[model samples]
Target: MSKASRYEWRDQQASLQERMKGFMENPGTEQLQAVLTEMHAYAAAAQDGSIDIPERFIAFS
Candidate 1:
């Protein structure tokens, strides 16, 4: 990947980590696991250039 793309990916990964942190702090194990599973799917889609950021942003918000 280009340097900028790599940086953007890193930012997205950090955002995912922050989201996971919030979920972990307030949710039960099963909920947190579910979030993690969704996160993995998101990451995979992102890596494949298939992530719909606008849609995901709305869903996440």
Candidate 2:
């Protein structure tokens, strides 16, 4: 790739990484709900006997 193209790709990657970092740090309501729902469902039915939980979560009973 050309120098300019390489730079552009790097910039895009950096932007995506930053966005992901921010999301992980503070996800919105929808994101939090979806994750909780998924976890609840997994807990209810763990067919695979394995689940990957996120580093942050809040489950309301």
Candidate 3:
């Protein structure tokens, strides 16, 4: 790789490392569970035909 490409790769790797370090510091289990529960509720609603599937979700049959 050229010198410029090597520098760019180092910068990208450093940014990714920083993001990963920050993510490791806050795992947010409770928040994740709550969101999962909400998604399950939405899935149930869609199955029941009472509510439409959310626009952003691509649930596989």
Tens-place lDDT digits, model 2, residues 1-61: 4556455544544454565565588899765665565446555533543433334545464
Q: Distance (Å) between predicted and true CA of 19, model 3? A: 0.4
lDDT of 2 at 55: 42
Model 2: residues with Cα > 4 Å off, grouped in runs = 29-61
By lDDT, the candidates rank as 1, 2, 3
Which sections of candidate 1 miss by over 4 Å?
28-61
**Model 2: C-alpha RMSD to truth?**
14.5
TM-score of 3: 0.44
- Number of backbone collisions per candidate, in order? 0, 0, 0
By TM-score: ranked, best first: 1, 2, 3
Error of 2 at 29 (Å): 4.8
lDDT of candidate 3 over 1-61, digit per residue (tens): 4556455544544454555555567657755555556556545755776543333433364
- Model 2 global lDDT (CA atoms, 0 to 1): 0.53
Model 1 whole-model lDDT (C-alpha atoms): 0.67
